[model samples]
Target: MFPIRDHNPSGRVPYVTYALLAVNIAVFVVSWFGLRSEYALAEFYYTWGLVPAWLMQGEGYSTLISHMFLHGGWMHLAGNMLFLWIFGDNLEDVLGHLRYFLFYLACGLAAAALQVAGDPGFDGPLIGASGAIAGVLGGYLVLFPRARVDVLLIFIIFFRVFSIPAWVVLGIWFAVQSFNGYSATADGVAYLAHVGGFIAGAVLVLPVLLRRGFWVQNKGKPPHPAAEYLFSPSRIPRVPKR
Candidate 1:
């Protein structure tokens, strides 16, 4: 299942979120198109993406921040950007532009730290906004547990949309990340980074959640009115199997 959108809407314009999206996209575009050869791309990723071993050896210190904007592939970038687009605005809305940006950076840094802790000797580059985007998902779960999200479920040739609570969506995601982080032996994905980023985001947002009495005042939903979406049925006609 993939979340397409959320009912929780931010009151503000979310300039920071838009800016982040733009920067990430720009970086990906430059790396994807401007770098013509596989070697060049690999070199670029090595320089910008976080390599735990290099970091542990007191090198590539800037990668902790740069790696958040680097992605392994098009799908990787698309997925991370989509998650950020879905969950980022609301958190930015509550935290304000500057605080939310700082929170994102802190969560990214924490994620990198955990990834390094998990595999300090690994040399492969860790690239993607997934770790930081995971943080946004964490914050969204805390602030809007009951907010409805429209998810697209894909099963073989079947496809359908479902409106589920934020807790269910993010909760399942977190559980999967944690499980994979613990069980996987050689998967390239940085599941531990995701876990750490998520925890950091949730912990960082606790103060806001408490100060606003979000649980008491609004039952963990968005402070402002939630957005309502009207989903129209698909126009394509279904074809029977031959």
Candidate 2:
């Protein structure tokens, strides 16, 4: 199950969030079209994506930032963008544009560091905005645990949407990431980076959460009015029984 949207709406327009989405999409398009062959794509990833081995050797330092904008595939790009779109605006609203951008970068750097520390010998390129977006999820959970999120669950041919608490969704996500980080095989997913970014984001946003007295006053929910979406009846006319 993955969250499709949240009830929490930001009080201000999230310019930084929109800019991030635009940048990631533009970079993906450039990478998708510019790299005509697999070899060239691989070369591009190696050069721009974070390589743990190179990072450990104090090489390809630029990848630490570049990798956050690069994605492994279309689904990877889509998934990261979706998460960022869902959770990022609220944090940007709270942190403001400049600070939010810095927080995103800091969380991404922390994620890269943890991934390198987790498996320093691995030479594969680590690319995706998941680590950074995971940080956004972390901060959102801290500030809006009680917020309602609509989650879509897919069971092969069956599908359904459920409204659940933000804590439930994000908490389960963190648990899965942590569990996979420890128990899963080499599936090319940087679970350690996700974990590190999440923790970093939670810690980084603590001050804002505290100053707002969100816990004491709002009780972990967003201070602003939560957006409520009501599903209306289908517009299609029903067929009469024969």
Candidate 3:
């Protein structure tokens, strides 16, 4: 299951979220052409992607930050951007532009650090904005535990969209990452980095969340309210012919 959208509406416009989405897409387009040539792609990744082994050797430390902006392929970029688009605006609305940007970078750095720790001797290029986006998911869960997220579920030739609590969606995602991290094989993904970024995002937002009285205000309420759209819920057909 993957989230398609959320029911919660932001109290304010999220310009920063839009800007971030634009930047990520622009960067991906530029990098896509580079991937056409193997040497060019390698050179690009060498300079921008995070290499755990190089970092362990006490060099190219900046890649930890740069890698968050680079992605491996079209699907990778699309998935990350889709997530950022869905959950980022509300957080940006709550945290404001500057603070949200800082929070994102910090989470990315922490994620890379965790990945490095997971495999200090492994030599491979790590590229993607997933870690930073994972951070956004973490923050979203803490701030909007009761918010409703619409998840698109696929089963063979069948597809359906269902609404569920944010806590349930994000909680399941974290559990999967932890499980995969522990059971990873030789050529598997770095599930640990995703977990690390998620943890970092949640922890880093604690102070701000506390200061804003989020814990108290959100005690028994959902994050904001259901989104107001041109069409009403009645437009949806009832299941089982109602």
Residues 1-242, model 3: lDDT tens digits: 89888888788788888888888888888888746897888889888888888888888878878888887778888888988988998888888889999999988888888888988887778988888888998988888888888888899998877777889999999999998888874554678889999999898888877898886887724556678544323446667954
Q: Rate the local accuracy (lDDT) of all candidates.
A: 0.90, 0.91, 0.83
TM-score of each: 0.94, 0.93, 0.91
Off by over 4 Å in 2: 230-242
Evaluated against the true structure, the overall lDDT of model 2 is 0.91
- Please identify which of the two predictions, 1 or 3, would achieve the higher TM-score against the true structure: 1
Model 1 lDDT tens row, 1-242: 89999888889999999999999999999889999999999999899989999988999998889999998888888999999999999999999999999999999998989989989998989988888888888988988999888899999999988888899999999999999999964668899999999999999999998998877888877777877766734557999999
Residue 37 in candidate 2 has what lDDT?
99
TM-score of 2: 0.93
- Candidate 3, which ten residues in sequence have the lowest lDDT sum? 228-237
> Which of 1 and 3 is ahead in lDDT?
1
Pairs with steric clashes in candidate 3: none
Please state the error at residue 97 of candidate 1 in Å: 0.2
**lDDT of each residue in 1-242, candidate 2, tens digit only:** 89899888899999999999999999999989988999999999999999999888889999999999998889999999999999999999989999999999999999988989989988999999988998999999998899889898899998877888999999999999999999854788999999999999999999987897767888877777877776622446889999
